[model samples]
Target: MALPSRASGGRPSARATDTALTLVVTAVVVAWTVVAMQYEDEPLSSTLVGWALIGVGCGALHFRRRHPVAVAVVTLAVSTVYYPLSAYDGPLMVTFALALYTASAEGRFTAAVALGVITLLAVGFGEAHQTGGNRQIDDTSLFMLAGWLISLVAIGRAQRTRTAYLHEVEQRALAAEREQEARARESATEERLRIARELHDVLGHSISLINVQSSAALHKLGKKPEPSAALTTAEEALEAVKATSKDALRELRATLGVLRQADEAAPTAPTSGLDRLDELVERARSTGIEVRTRTEGTPRPLPPPLDLAAYRIVQESLTNVTRHAQAQSALVTIAFTDADIRVRIDDDGRGSADEQAVGSGIRGMAERAKAFGGELTAENTADGFRVSARLPLTTIGGTQG
Candidate 1:
């Protein structure tokens, strides 16, 4: 069987205090009854029975919190009977006060009011009966009843105030938790988008260079007379691969460095739009892959993100050709229209049915285009695969820095 819950575990200090109070009050009541019997010359039997009733009524105090209404009713009944018979005041009045307090504290306001009324009536009627018709309404009894009623109302108000305070605290806690969860989710989404951007920048450029260099090396190898030249071309291509891998690692490490250190430095600057297109194409030509480049309309400076996005689209398309297509040549077209800049990479490569599911390269390219308020489309035509992207110049800004 399971242990009791934390809420059910009795408060040791509170329970001990209650028990001590009950014991002390019981002793006092018994002593008072004995003294009253000696002074009034009452019989010993009457005093003894009164002491027993007070003791029994005091026992009800232990269960006040658990059964406030019942305890209150029982104490009121016993006090009504024992008050007239005993010369001294009984413990029932004290017990009744405690019962009223417990009822308010435990959220039983209706029961507390009823008990208070009953107690006042019993006290008034018992006094009137004891003195016969000669007894008059006195200030002492009125004052005592007023004090009890005030105490009951005061306890009820205090309990209500505490309950309101606790409810407000709970609402604030729930709101804070919800806000924290929202912030975490937002941070995760931003990180994912940042990673996508980095992958597009790194892989797109590196793979394009590899495709170009490998083609150049293969062409030289075919010449048979240029073994040394072919070897040099292969070496250069390998060097490019190593450089690409190093750059990728550096970017990745920078992104993840925050997890390891509190004072890590920021990442290095990224490559921007159309900065090294000439060198990129030339390197590929040095290999065996033939690339033709064309530009239409006046070439204007573009936003950093748009320029980088344009570069990535072409780079990824060329990389795909080198890896999957057996084509001999590729074409890169850039058109600066009145409102937008358009890019297209066409290659004479074997197109497969699952072109969209090629690799992360395509997905990264698409993500880059979307980030800049642009669109990317890929289609496998009869001759080869085509990748195209269009970005609005107005939305992203004028040019790369």
Candidate 2:
């Protein structure tokens, strides 16, 4: 027989199947040996020896999975030695089919085919082929033996094919699941970064304004000796602080509302965009920072996402002017082109290199520009610090892909 191959199907229930095959084959062999002795007058011990040999051969079949070829060879050899020597004149052979099935299922094709042919030749020499009065019965038994061998081999081959197919399908399913998990993790990371940027824009601007207003109120309350003048300045500072705090709370609530949404629906209130640029510029002006706004092209409405990004860029820039630029004057310029929108924020503040602080505001603005298939650059110019962004109009707004 061909050498044994690795089968995809695992071992069969060994104990039950092996025990059943052994019992059935042993009974048949013992019955045949005893009846043959009736004609030969052989001693009972001789009959028992034949039965013991048949039992041992059947027991070897138990190792068919790990050593199919070896089991088939041993079983065939044992049967050959006992069958012809026992003077058997009957068609009583059985049990050897186990080795043949296993060989065809797990063995190489050439080896299994050769082993089958050899086994058929051995069957031809058995008592089943001997011419006698019971020739019809013996011939029938021989025919059945050939058919059983063919059927068993076919069954084994099919089992191997099915087991291999199942294993392949299982592997593909696991791979698909793993890939899905990886995509989910990547999406979660992107969402977290977006939330961080929103919080930074809201907190950084509001806190800077609040700090400025509180300091001014404290100064006016102590510096001016006149009760009415001092009271008026302090009240104005307090009013500014209250307005800043309220706006901060409103913006923070809107940002957090995105997380509370359970479905894809429009937000209850509109988000900030270029339309709010006036308020932003006025806020900086209130802090004694002279501001100028300029437009190069005809003003037109922009897509929502691009508009929001543009507003944040100007807002964060002005906030920086208050915190680090230490500039007395700033310029906000916006240009609309056929294919893209351009934004520039320039400050004539402490133009020193040390005035530039590349922090979360800058990174967040750059990331926002990138979202719309755009780019942003921040650098210290001789006049002051300049932050510029170019956003492509092609995919500027609407829902993200």
Candidate 3:
């Protein structure tokens, strides 16, 4: 984000500006010294010495950034000597003022102030006496010089303070950007894990059934030949495998589509939301488990991700009920409040809570609810086992359902 130096325009380069400033001050001081000398009865040698002193003082400014206080002292000493010895007056104080400004701007405020005070005192003393009838300074000029010096110091200090403030603001902006990027990376990592869990829940159940059915068919074929019965068993197993594999492929495609970039293509299949609750119920019913579902409040639209989470939690709970709970019938109740949606599945099964508590399906269900800033718990009730979940509506834009 740092800009190129050339972007600041031609003369903003500090070294180049300093060099130019030295040239200008040299010209101005030489001109003033020449004009003043024309009115005085001073010797040619004295004029040469005055010009040499101006060159030395103005030349020192080039190193002001590196040695501001030293440069200021050198310029001050040159001006103090040049005014008294020379039989003419010049604007030599220009070089000294520039040095004082540089010193204050470079964070040498105390030294610049002390030097300014010393120069003012020297001028005050010079005003009370004459330097070889030259009358180099007076009371009015001393006050004016003091005011100019104070203004230069103030301007330089203000510049330094402004620069410091700007630097602090830029640093804070960079820190905020870095923090935001870290949060984005963490969010991406969490999303990948959630997708992996969804894939497992989608394909695990049907694949397990295929494994069981195929194993049974193999065991039956190993028995003494009974042609018609064996053929019927083999046909049913193959059919079941075909249906299961087809469902797995469909869900797999849907899950994988979520990973694709936005510009490529969108998913062709619909996302699984609470609208597909009937399909889930039918699938569970085919497993010979009577599942009765009822909604306790008004059914409305919900955020797609939230809806999918709710559906997944219910689907996983029913999966556990059918797989582990040897219950005759189960009831799935969905009650909606203004703040959240609650899902409770109760089954009259003899399944032990301690055994089923450690299952991955339960953990996945809990994770799904938690993704929506909600909670889930599976415990045994008086009659049977119960799986409960509460999915919040406030987060991810309070969409009601």
Cα RMSD to the true fold for all candidates? 5.6, 4.9, 6.0
lDDT of 3 by residue, 1-401 (tens): 21212325444687778888888888888888778767887777887888788888989988877788999999999998888778877888788999999888877888989998998887777666665766656667777888988998998888777766777887899999999999899877777777778887787666654665577678878895589998987897787677767766877788888678989787788887888888777666645578999999988788887888888878777777766777778999988889999999999888888766656488877877876789999999899999999998997532211
TM-score of 3: 0.69
Which has the greatest lDDT? 3
**Residue 329 displacement in candidate 1 (angstroms):** 4.1
Error of 3 at 304 (Å): 3.3
Local error of candidate 3 at 366, Å?
2.1
For model 3, which pairs clash?
none
TM-score of each: 0.72, 0.79, 0.69
lDDT of 2: 0.74
After best superposition, candidate 3 residue 234: deviation in angstroms?
3.0
Q: Judged by TM-score relative to the true structure, which candidate is superior, 1 or 2?
A: 2
Off by over 4 Å in 2: 1-55, 82-96, 103-110, 125-143, 222-225, 261-266, 351-355, 396-401
Q: In candidate 1, which residue pairs clash?
A: 212-284, 215-287, 215-288, 216-287, 216-288, 273-307, 302-399
* Whole-model lDDT, model 3: 0.79
RMSD of model 1, in Å?
5.6
